[model samples]
Target: MKDQITIVGNIGSDPELRRLADGTPIASFRIASHERRYDQKTSSWVDGTPSWYDVSAFRSLGEHVLASVKRGQRVIVTGALTIRRWENGERSGTAAEIEATAVGHELRFGTTVYTASAPRREEPAPPPADAPDPEPVAAGAWAAPGAETPF
Candidate 1:
């Protein structure tokens, strides 16, 4: 089985979304995770070297990510890690990447409001010119006031 990686960090930049030729959506962004160590001398926690990673998410998840995530927001991501070696002239380095399977905001640091997105549905064809206008329906129980609850 392939190894999976999970990282909890702050997004270092705004997510960029794109579509492949076949119309598959993808979103890419950078994340920075840091380790803290306690120092007896200063008696305080200090940040160690931060690890930076490139994260890519695809399809509907990518769409949702683009809409929900933003720079500096804490997030948790899980996916397969990919390492690639590269060289240019006399310089060489290894690139770290994650093909993200899941991504979401980390709520421990703050609060967020959750709203359900409207479901997608195909519209019916327009009625004949002689057809009467459809009657409007009243908002149902689902739309009742005070329906939203804090997470």
Candidate 2:
């Protein structure tokens, strides 16, 4: 996989939002990017094969995606790509996904207003001294982003 990947495409589905018991937010969606080619026989441009990516964002980035992105909206995503193979009851296939670090509206498609949010603290807040450590949240309880999640 590449160290980093940048893709510009339209959101293929609505962003699914959820929060961990501790209040950390998560957002996920699918993006479809296509290549266009000029066909001499057709005498016009034609769409080549489309590539789909299952994208996920976490914490404040996740919150931003949930609030901003929507189905069919053009956007830019910068992230890391991971590939996996799975076998389920005799069904097997490969999956491609992106762990998005940044997501935003594609300015080339149209104009959009931007509201910058405050930055997060460098150090996470410690739980109250009197409070017990909270249990980790299970991913199974929440719906996976897109058709699958990179667990």
Candidate 3:
């Protein structure tokens, strides 16, 4: 089973984008999610320790992340989670990571304008030289009575 998780956090650093030898692109960054609590005695809000996660996005998503995300920006990321432990000499630590499937701005903090990307397509092959021509449709032939044609 896959361990999937979603996190809302502030980006800790600019995304680093790189390409593999096969030309596949990947972007990596870190995010810190802090917990806020109300302290009754102090009568104030306090910030708890933050949980940090390293995130990576691949392919077109990576390209878009490199172009759109920045350090300190609030974002929402959803992906598969991974935890790893490592030791160097006598020191050891655990690392949390996410292989992000989706990354986007957290709109509660701000607004963003979205632009649609162009659709990808391959050129259609030319018809065979000896093929018969296609039949032409009469103007408004497919339109119902009293219905306006989109064209």
Candidate 4:
């Protein structure tokens, strides 16, 4: 699609907030996307090119973004690209922008990590006050990491 965009990058600086004429909120930041090249003989990775993107979040996302996100944090932003035209000192230029909607933390290269967020509260009743904590499970107790699954 012409408007589709997906970006994974490190935050360049803390997000800044602005207000529209009608009081709409706008949050803007710079993202630096990096790539690495691998050397077959050396079995090592070398630094590669990086592309910078300018992103913006609006409304509630904008209001909370500045406080929740920080510079240098790695994140994945999914949104659409909009080509905006504006005049700069009598000169016109096009700018690339992503109206971010879904933002997530990206896992490391070749590694899959799942995060469990805050637990929900049950309305019926709380757990027994004297209930003992669950036993600690050993790493090997569960399936081995990267183990093959037979279907």
lDDT of each candidate versus the true structure:
0.89, 0.87, 0.92, 0.78
- Count: clashes, candidate 3: 0
Model 1 ranges off by over 4 Å: 119-151
lDDT of 1 by residue, 1-151 (tens): 4569999999999999999999999999999999889999999999989899999999978888899999999999999998889999999999899999999888899887777677666787989999998776455544444444344
Off by over 4 Å in 4: 83-94, 107-151
- Estimate the TM-score for candidate 3: 0.78
| TM-score per model over all chains | 0.74, 0.73, 0.78, 0.60
TM-score of 2: 0.73
Model 2 lDDT tens row, 1-151: 4568899999999999888899878898999999888999979999878799999899889988998889999999999998889899989988778999999898986989899787554776877899987777566654532334436
Candidate 4 lDDT over residue span 8-90, tens digit each: 88899889999999999988998888887898989999867877778899987776676567798888898888877889897
Question: Which residue pairs in model 4 clash with each other?
Answer: none
Candidate of highest TM-score: 3
lDDT of 3 by residue, 1-151 (tens): 6699999999999999989999999999999998989999999999989999999999988999998999999999999999989899999999999999999999998988777676566788999999999777577775654456677
- The local lDDT score (0 to 100) that residue 15 gets in candidate 3 is 100
